[model samples]
Target: MKILFLGQLIGKQSIAFVKEHLASLKAEHQIDCTIAVADAVTGGYGLGKNHAFYLRKLGIDLLLGGEAMLSKRDLVEELAQIHFVLRPANFTGIGNFGYGMRHLHTPKNQQLNIINVMGMMGFHRVHASNPYQLVNKILDNPKHPSPFTLVAFSAIASAEKQTMAHMMAGKCSAIIGYGAKAITLDAQIIDETAYITDVGRISAPFSVAGFTPESEIERYTTQRPRKSEELISDEIELQAVVITLDDETGKATHLQPLRATYPLNVKAPANTSAESTTP
Candidate 1:
């Protein structure tokens, strides 16, 4: 039971590299549930309510969203009191604050059922609604009852080869895609049992898909276009994806795409032996 999966945070230096790597990734990779996707976590687009309560105080229980998380229309009633932050179920007129499927109870009981969809070509072009008919009506109305179900998509990167994301990966067990950008693109499973992945982009490992590749060359600049430049950064990186569930049928048997760069909360001056530290 691992399940890390973070992508697309894009701002505040990806929330200071997830608050400096949440206690060494749950004390050296014992992570049991840490998610992300706050549509450019503030100043890159949205994500408020005090940065979603400081990413649930740096533990990040949940938060999957997109279409720039609705670019701050006054924080949607403070992102609707953060009841685990979902928001994508096709987002057509956003009436309710947020949440498009929910039912997580892990710590061993493991009855997940997440959901959150998007893809109808999301991101800045916005206008969603029909992420495969709202994931078949959230697996036929799910607000409860679950053995395992996951699905977090936020389109872009050309909608990740839409066959409706391999047709919702045969009705969900894992499919956290979200437009991968400069790396982290591994897991796959479509039509034999659901498991798709894309965990890159928490922002800046030399910026491009997390922005500041000169804001995409100033949106394709013109007027004698032989000049180009970009690479602004605060030097961050935290791609994620570490699903190895099946703690008795949560069934995500393997998915490990993690990457942490940046001083990772410091403390690294201990290996000195080039002839006794080059005396």
Candidate 2:
């Protein structure tokens, strides 16, 4: 079985750009299931329930979001009952938002469990518990009848992701990863035991990680440039990762990194401007 995961979608163009490719890839690749990051779907802020529903209808199996998705009031209310989406499971608070994980009831006759967790060190406002602890609780639950298929996250760093994958080892099939910023196709295979991969963004193919470069250049142009909230890219490509699972073992054995670029032009500032708008 093949699972397709998309990076963060920042705006309407990004959404449309993703959908256009998703339809083609679904048929061409025989994609069994698909998931997309949700925080920036509605004008780069929190996702609206309506937007979530639209994405579901467009063939994405799950809509995954980060801390920003919880910022809206009405959206949070709807997300609590929305079965096709998930938020970080590690959050701790009185009125926290949606589920941190979900099980896929595939009509194609396959059962897959997917989880979402957040790292403790990020800019999020909620008090987040240790994700490793939460994973232990869920995996150890007697009432839970399914195997832990995969875990996804939207966070500040990759260090935690690699650590979690190494810790989980043979307990889960694969760990899905993508940071809030940084657009690179990176996957780490731990002792041939598990897979951890990050899918960055689907924004302007020429812009920096899909955001306008004015802010990024101004902030980091002086002393030393560092990759922060801006994904590590000046060109846009709708990036995603495809993992093929072992039919019986359900362990992910093959990892495929995918990217598609458009003809869009992103202008650079006068100081850093490039003469070419070509892809």
Candidate 3:
């Protein structure tokens, strides 16, 4: 099965970009499922109920949440109703609202299991348990023998993300890390598991991680408390990875990084698909 994993999407323009390019992606390749990070999907905070349903209609099969999962209180009350959305399993306290793991079946009858976890290091507002311990318990004991198992680890620290990927290299089919908002060049397969440090963000490329550079600068330079980040919509692009899993084994046979620019700019190609670089 071919799974297209996209980076964190911020604001309305990013969602529009997804609606525009998702069709192109399907036309270019036979994508069985599309998964995207749900951090800042709403007004640069959390995934809202309306936006969540709209994204699902746009063809995103699964939406994974990070530390900002519960940023919207109204969404928190309705999270249990959204089956396709997942909150971090390790998230503790009253803020933690939805299920972190889900089992699904592809169109071709492939068993798929997805798990979401968050790190405890940098997220001060969120209280969470150890992701390492939670992931170990989930993978060590399987409720069902799924051919494909995917883990989405959201962390602020690079070291923590890398450690989780390496620790669960052979246990799962793939491990995708996010929350840094910058795509890492290290996309490889370790022990048949596909791993990438950060999938990047799908938003205006000119700004600072989807926010206006000037606003971010002002926040960093001045002592005045930082305001809500402002998202830019000048030129948007999709940064993601495509993982192809073996039918029988569920191990990743090919891992390819994909980047596509919207509005068909002259300088950059519409879609760039690379060959599998990992052995």
Candidate 4:
């Protein structure tokens, strides 16, 4: 009953969601290993200070990019069991004490392995970094254990992952796509690998963005020449636009326009003609 969890980081919320879901997945599927591939945590949908601290508190091991993970090795080691794998992950450093974790998800000889790769468009800046290369490198290297399952949290569109699906179709036992990209990628993987997509690794409430709302009401008082009067109010809509880049592509792929309406509540500047009078 061993399993792997795969995914891409969209933001702090993404990590929050994964950490929340991991416990349930472990209990339900009996997962034994997890390998998450990501760009810089701070740069993309990374773990912020608070979120990072919280994740450590939850006992989830995290692998940060070379710069972030290697520089703060001392602090990272003391805080939690998380490891920050330097760029270009090879099997040699797979069990490094400072940058990697070993003997985790124990009961050695487990069959499951999870690999989460960040796919947000343009969210990463590493040179010559490609999923195909990374996966191929891992396969070519003799350092990693074999006869284990591999799952990828690929965020590429369904069409893009197809090529990889073909290559790894039979090599790996199974592949599962996660996050919003799964909607289409899952179907493609089925067609290629003859294996249906696994929905277990993904978190619910899977929309890519998060937001909050605020409302304001302005009240006014006015008199119309001592005549009987009535009050009126009008609502106006205000829109806010937030542009965000896709995590993997690092391009402005998402444009979120938030629309909100607020009532100005004007009283005719206190000088409106009397519509009704009984003086």
Best by lDDT: 3
TM-score of each: 0.32, 0.82, 0.91, 0.46
- Which scores greater on TM-score, model 3 or model 4? 3
Tell me which of candidates 3 and 4 scores higher on lDDT. Answer: 3
lDDT (0 to 1) per candidate: 0.64, 0.67, 0.80, 0.35
On residues 1-279, what C-alpha lDDT tens digit does candidate 4 reach at each position?
233333333233334444545466445444444334332233232233444454445444443332223223333344334433322232233243342222233355332333433333333332224566666665566354544434353343444345556766655544544333223223322322323232212211322121111101111133333322222224322222222222232222322332333333322122111122211
Clashing pairs in 3: none
Q: How many clashing pairs per prediction, in order? A: 0, 3, 0, 15
Top candidate (TM-score) = 3
Flag regions of model 2 displaced more than 4 Å. 94-96, 191-194, 215-236, 263-279
Off by over 4 Å in 3: 228-231, 264-279
Candidate 2 vs 4: which has more TM-score: 2
Residue-by-residue lDDT tens digits, candidate 3, 1-279: 888888898666677777767878865778877889976777776777777888899889899878788776666788887789989988777653678898877789777899999888877777889999999998989788787999998988889989998899889999998888888899999999999988888877777777777777877788465654645454687789998889889898888887766762322211111111100
Which digits, one per residue and each the tens of the lDDT, describe model 2 over residues 194-279? 46446777777666655567655765676454332333233347777777777677766777777777533333211111111101
TM-score of 3: 0.91
| Whole-model lDDT, model 2 | 0.67
* Candidate 1 residue-wise lDDT, 1-279, digit = tens: 676777777656677677776667766778767778776566555566667777777788888776656555555665666678777877887777767677766677566777877677534556876677778676777767564777777665544535655766556567777755444454655553345545667766766666556545655674343322223354677777766656665556676677767653432121111111000
> Which residue runs does candidate 1 get wrong by more than 4 Å?
1-5, 9-31, 35-107, 114-116, 122-129, 141-144, 147-151, 155-201, 205-215, 223-234, 237-279
